[model samples]
Target: MTETPTATKEKPAHRSGLAAATREFVLIVVGALIVSSILRAFVGQMFIIPSESMQNTLLVGDRVVVEKLTDVERGDVVVFEDPGGWLGQEESGQKRGSVGRFFEVVGLLPDSSHGHLIKRLIGMPGDKVACCDAKGRLMVNGKPLDETSYLYPGDAPSAMDFQVTVPAGHVFVMGDHRSESGDSRVHLSDTGPNGGSPGDAAFVPLDKVTGRAILVVWPANRFDKLEIPDTFKDVPAAAAPPPDKPSISLTPPPK
Candidate 1:
């Protein structure tokens, strides 16, 4: 009997070791979650392309990294919250439950099903944006935008003609696949149910922009850094129009 006891004497020690290992693993997982949450809340986040709106530049299903702190400039691809129901529905039509949405908020999952939208920032505040010059190019503050570098093949700059002055503190955005995309041009006439102004419904406020999309990260083969097109560099600064001179109305001399 004494000899048999020797074989089982170390069982408690083995059990203790296993328990310690499990505890360590749980701690590691919790730590990782905390780090991920912090990074996503304040630094950057991953978003998936949900439509062909930005096609040829970003395909559907492509995951992109959006930098939260970067300066958004003209021609930068940006992700923004839907302003005043601007985005009616998602192309994929995917829905997420509350649990899944929680994970997305914590950076544990990609928010592909959310109502956010991605588009190229075409006009900055106070810029005049118009469609179709003589050569069928978009005009930004009197400069013709050469969009061939990123526009979908054989796609026109815009099929629908429009002209708008981007109001202060707002931006005008458009998609590369102009014909298929319902971007700023599509919302130009949306006055909302409350009879809000046109620009109020169409323009995206600066505060609504989440971040600038800077990289394509999904599918491995499609990985690439997004860069501003050379055409944006050639765009001239928007010149300020002269202030209207105060009209001097001549009052009838005591008629």
Candidate 2:
């Protein structure tokens, strides 16, 4: 031991501090990633407006926060999975390669390119929805919807005429820009896989709805909370059909 002690090699204080700082930084990043993932998966998610379907209300390039736990109600704007190839050849602005998709899933990027559609819930299951009831207002279960508050200025409630009873377990949806939107009304006659009838493919299944859009988060100037217009407030519950009538057909004859 008295002999010359072997030279002790110790890490410099600065080096040790650098290592600790690097580890802390990495941990913080990972923790943030986990929290974001949880929020995006269970609580809420961000979506980008890909088309002009919901003009004035939701313009293309607008970013919105979709609340997953909220109930989907009539007049609520919602994002949903495309039902039965309804979004034919529609390109998602955020469509990316594998690596890009991974980032989107991890909540690192905006979910603008996903294969989903956005629209206002117009009719609940079992509601008879019809277009242009004399005053050009949409009628649901005999009650007219005064859509002027949300309908794009100068745009009619619908350009084409249609009347269909929303089947159970599904919803009838339409965009604010009815003229430009390819919504439930457009697909009323498209037969689904089961091939039941013309109106069978028009409704979006309840399960397909992702979430209700609660806020617009992008384009700072456009920041605002989406609210249910007063028009939806006055809609009375659908009237029950008489027992003697096996079926209820509220659709008026086409001109």
Candidate 3:
């Protein structure tokens, strides 16, 4: 009867409920950030193409999706850390703001457009990679590659002529726009012959590879899949060195 006697304070209970909800929201946000960070560190991340090194394949300002789940393969477009002096003088000084850095750490922003280089995997460990033949084509493992499908509109396979067997645990890379790219070709300290490939900073170490660029996600017009062209399908395996470490053939084993 004294029923509505003393009205218990409803404010405290409502305040407690709001506080609990806020905590849950915060935790969810934090947990999401953590998952994104882990994925970026070990699974996949976004990278912004800073230069036209990749050209029509990847233009300036294009956002590329680099995945770390699979092994690097020949014909795969890859993004890697600067092996040494690969970056130009202007690239060394680029930096992101604190806000951008935070986003980068959480996988919301692209990797620093500076420290990474993207190129096609032209040679695998111990594979011989060389320039144009009589028909003006690139050669891999003694077979010719008709690169017309991916090469920039007017770019040649390569203006320079050289051959190098990729050293063990290293890979040889080049840009689609051969003329504009300062790839492994220009960085060679010495050439490789008879399986004696010069590795002195000429090749990119396996550990230095960030991941393969599999997709272009931004600038809707440029949206596309970065796939191994049909040319690689016909590429034969590289012959392993006799009495030496065997090199892995990048082409798929014949079924």
By TM-score, the best candidate is: 2
- CA lDDT scores, all candidates in order: 0.79, 0.80, 0.80
What is the C-alpha local distance difference test score of candidate 2?
A: 0.80
* Candidate 2 positional error at 164, Å: 2.1
CA deviation > 4 Å runs, candidate 1: 1-11, 192-195, 241-255
Where is model 3 more than 4 Å wrong at Cα? 1-11, 90-93, 190-199, 242-255
Better of 1 and 2 by TM-score: 2
- Candidate 3 achieves a global lDDT of 0.80
| Per-candidate clash tally | 0, 1, 0
Model 2 lDDT per residue over 73-181, tens place? 8899999988876775543455878887777787887786477999999988767778767777788777788888899999988877777767777888999998878
Q: Please write out the lDDT profile of model 1 over residues 1-255, one tens digit for every residue.
A: 355554545568879999999999999988988998898877889998888899999998899999898779999999998777666565543668899877887898887747788999998877777776777788887888889899999899988777777777778899998877888888776764456654456778889899899999888999999988888887777676411211111121111
**lDDT tens readout by residue for model 3, 122-166:** 988868777656777889888889888889889888776776677
Ranking by TM-score: 2, 3, 1
TM-scores for all predictions: 0.84, 0.89, 0.86
- Model 2, residue 180: distance off in Å is 0.6
RMSD of each: 8.0, 3.4, 6.2
